[model samples]
Target: MAIAARALGPSPYGPPEGGLRNAADLIVRDAVAYAGRCDPRVSVSGEVVTGGISAVLIGESRRAFAVVLGDRGLGGFTGLLVGSVAVQVTAHARCPVLIARGTARENGPVVVGVDGSPHSDRAVAFAAEEAVLRKTDLRAVHAWTGPASTRAGDMLPLVYDPELVGEDESRLLSEATAGLTERHPDLLVAHRVVRGRAARTLIGQSHGAQLVVVGARGRGGFTGLLLGSVSQALLHHAECPVAVVRAAEV
Candidate 1:
């Protein structure tokens, strides 16, 4: 389905009239035409609504399997990597939100961030399905940081073994992806546990990835926050398409 939203203005006399409606019609028409060319077997539909674009899209997202938007929209500054609409929709959408960005590499694997959160578990499942559909491997990555005291200059150095920390992180990754191979018998899955920040690690992995999948909110996210920092970072900096999956309600 192709949907377009137009911002309408108040008029004392009557409904405001101009080329905005025409522009919306043309956008929907072109989109429908393109979808038809891409796949004639699938039924295609279009709708043109009048409201804030982000709000309209978020309302429509309830029934959508995934809301796909471009990295940058028409209204944002040319230099902005991600537009305001994309960010807003991704944060509040009911389902997965995919931000279409750089060219997707045909042979790249599906990369997912695994942080042992319920949200991350959902992301892992989503990535596993995507990898199977794409006939590609799934790479689950878990990024961790050392103890906070180690980073503080004024604090006494804590005696903690780096090797033990690495092992624990690896175990976390294994647990997060425990049943993936069993669920997808034919899928190839790889695991990586890196000692770094989650956002930076995932962004680096995105360089040659077809898609990077992450939970909308991770372990560190507060209950009131819809989007987490890691997801936001990837939305702005990932080199490939990024899929932010919102965990289902308990």
Candidate 2:
């Protein structure tokens, strides 16, 4: 994890960056001892946001979870840039991003977004493992726009289109749910399929959720809309924590 901080002024508000190195080292050391995990590496790198500490973990195993710690209390001047660094990193990073507030609780349930992306498949694999390790129930949520589509003022099966779109959405949710079940049979899994905008749907669902996971980038680039817009939105404003997963091996 890349944790970077600088001593802008002094103590009380944002503690000096001096102790962060030792603190991060201690945490990693203890993790290796108790968790028996071995990334055998850690870092405290610099970023745009001054004073606040940001952690970036690199070279961790495919199954290893990366915790991006964002310290609370940003100076008014840097508040605007707070999300800038976190957002860019969250959007681009290959691993799951954990934005930890000073008040974050440990050993919490992990919430990941599944929108049928290949990236989502990878996320499911990762989150399921974490849940098993933490001994927590895994909530795999699928958000569908029953009525929201490209055309704003149009309906299919015009004769009696009693939410034909809704039926399709239900199928989408069912497929996503069933797909995960087949892939992760041993996982203690529970799923939710809700109707709303994708981002809004998941963000709202994540209120009581400990961690929110989504794809880093989706298939919505050019020819094929592969990624979910909702996934992008969740990274912007998730109540608890957010993790962006990439479907492909990057």
Candidate 3:
């Protein structure tokens, strides 16, 4: 395990000089000691840097299993939970980024967002592994918006049918989660097809979840884009820790 902290500025309002460094060292020692109490094989290290928090986190993510951030922090920045810094790091982190929400619980399902893209598929796999690790259930959620599109007055003449679209969305959700039960026979899985905006649906699910998993980029996003709107929204608004899984390269 690696514990890192960034010293942003020199002012008292900012981190005191060497404060982050000392915090980093303490975190490393405490983490190692805690892990040792749990199991003697765990080793940990410390890394403290003087730079922008988002930049340091992004850099650390290249080699870390996951980069975890608090839902809110003491930076005096207004956007704490769903803020710009969280958005930036979650969008661009190379590895999976986990935004810690509530207390890390030992129970409750691992919730994942699915959109029939390869990106979401990766999220499913990650969520599966997480479910196995947590010894919990996995809940796959998919959201569609026939009603919202109609409200937006963007409905096409023959192509826009609410019932058919909803069915298709359900089918896509099933297809995306297919074979997971067979692969992980011990893992229990459930799925829901919701009618609303994707972000709102996922955020609602987060209330009952221990962790919410999503793809860094989803089907609705451009290929070159670093993060989808839904992922960005979850990073800020989720009531539970949100995992943004990067898509595998072709």
Best by lDDT: 1
Please state the error at residue 129 of candidate 2 in Å: 1.8
Collision pairs in model 3: 82-236
TM-score per candidate: 0.87, 0.59, 0.79
Error of 3 at 63 (Å): 1.9
Write model 2 residue lDDT over 46-124, tens digit each, in one string.
3222232333333231345564646232343553523555655555455576665322235556776776556766777
Winner by lDDT between candidate 3 and candidate 1: 1
List runs of model 1 lying over 4 Å from the truth. 1-18, 147-157
Model 2 segments beyond 4 Å from truth?
1-67, 71-81, 101-109, 146-164, 177-186, 221-229
Ranking by TM-score: 1, 3, 2
Better of 1 and 2 by lDDT: 1
Worst 10 residues of 1 by lDDT: 147-156
The runs of at least 3 residues in candidate 3 whose Cα sits more than 4 Å from the true structure, single-residue gaps closed, are: 1-42, 103-105, 147-159
What TM-score should be assigned to candidate 3?
0.79
Q: Global CA lDDT of candidate 1, please?
A: 0.88
lDDT of each: 0.88, 0.57, 0.81
